[model samples]
Every structure is written in structure tokens, then in C-alpha cells.
Target: MIRGIRGATTADRDDEKEILLSTESLLKEMILHNNISAENVASVFISATHDITSVFPAKALRGFEEWKYVPVMCMQELDVPHGLSRCIRVMIHYNTSTHQSDIKHIYMKNAVSLRPDLKK
Candidate 1:
């Protein structure tokens, strides 16, 4: 079955390094907690707040050699009023046997407020 794992995190600033590092960290944590492999991943969709225009968050995936085959895309998050800033969100679609309810969605940094109930 194809499952979508959600994760979000905030960068310290709109710097390229900050965006790339934070994205990598969040992706690592999500994969670690869920025991997911790049091979099973179908694709990844990343969206960043308007304030973050330094670079594309999907660029971070290039650091992972095994993820070379993983199709990834990047876009700007909707500019909702009072929405989180400097935030990057990711949705990873992959083949998995795990039930949707059991998937561990990761929220870090200022994004913890986005889903207080999932905070841990």
C-alpha cells in the first residue's frame, strides 16, 4: 500500500544552509522513527513558506546518494493569514505495510505548534 508520511520544521532563517540543514534533519528523524528506506519511497513533496526563498528545500535530497531515484518536488506553501513562517513541510509517499494510524508524523522546532496533539 502507498502511505504518506507528513513532517514539518522551521528554519532559523531564510538562509540556504539553514533551510537545507533543517529539511535534512526533519527528513532523517521521520525516516528513523518510521524505519523507512529510500528504496520504498515513491516520491516527496516539499513546500516552504513565502519567506523562505533562499533555496529549494528539495535540494537537500541530493545529499542522499540512495535517494537519487526518488522523485521530489518543491513549491511555496499557501500564504494563510497568521500562518507559520520560515516553515518547510514535507509529504513522503512510499510503499509500506504499516497502517496509516501507526505512521509517525514528525513536527519539529516552531512547527510543533502546528500539531500540538502530535507533539512528543
Candidate 2:
């Protein structure tokens, strides 16, 4: 079965380094939470709020060879009236045997406020 795992995080600043580090941290958490290995990932979709133009969050994942074949695409989130700034959100699709509700979704830093209903 193909399941989607979601994760989001915010960078302290729009600097490339900050974006990369924050995203890498967020992805790592999601990977750990879901007990996901690179081979299980089908693809990852990343969206960053308009303010985060310094770097592509997907590049952060490429730093590790594990993600080399894990097709990733990064896009800009729509600008909303009160949307959070400098945020990076990811949805990872994986072919897994786990049930949908069993998947762990991660939200960290300032992005946590976006989904107060989820387990942080």
C-alpha cells in the first residue's frame, strides 16, 4: 500500500544554511517517527512558504546518498493572508504495509501551530 507521511518545520531565517538545516532536521524526524528507510520512500513533495527562497529544501535530503533515488520536488506554498513564514512542509509517499492511521506525521518548531491536532 502507498501511504503518505506529512511533516513541517520553520527556519529561523531565510538563509540557505538555516533552510537546509531546519529541513534536514524535519525530514530526519519524519523518517525516524515512521521507521522509514530510504528504500521505502516512493517520493517526497516539499512546499515552502514564499519567504523561503534562499534554498530548495529538497536539496537537503540529497546530502545523504540514501535519498539519491527518492524523487523529490520542491514548490512554493501559496501566499495566504496569515500563513506562517519561512516554513517548509513535506509529504512523503511510501509503499508500506503499515495502516494509514498508523503513520506518524511530524510538525516541529513554529510550524507546529499549523496543526495543533497532530501529535508533535
lDDT of each: 0.95, 0.92
lDDT of 2 at 53: 82
TM-score of each: 0.97, 0.96
| Tens digit of per-residue lDDT, candidate 1, span 59-107 | 9988999999999999999999999999999999989999988999999
Lowest summed lDDT over 10 consecutive residues: which window, candidate 2? 111-120
Q: Name the candidate that leads on lDDT.
A: 1
How do the residues 47-112 of candidate 2 rate in per-residue lDDT, one tens digit apiece? 999998888999999998878988999999999999998989999999899988888899999988
- Cand. 1 TM to true fold: 0.97
Model 2 misplacement above 4 A: none
Candidate 1: residue 88 lDDT (0-100): 98
Best by TM-score: 1
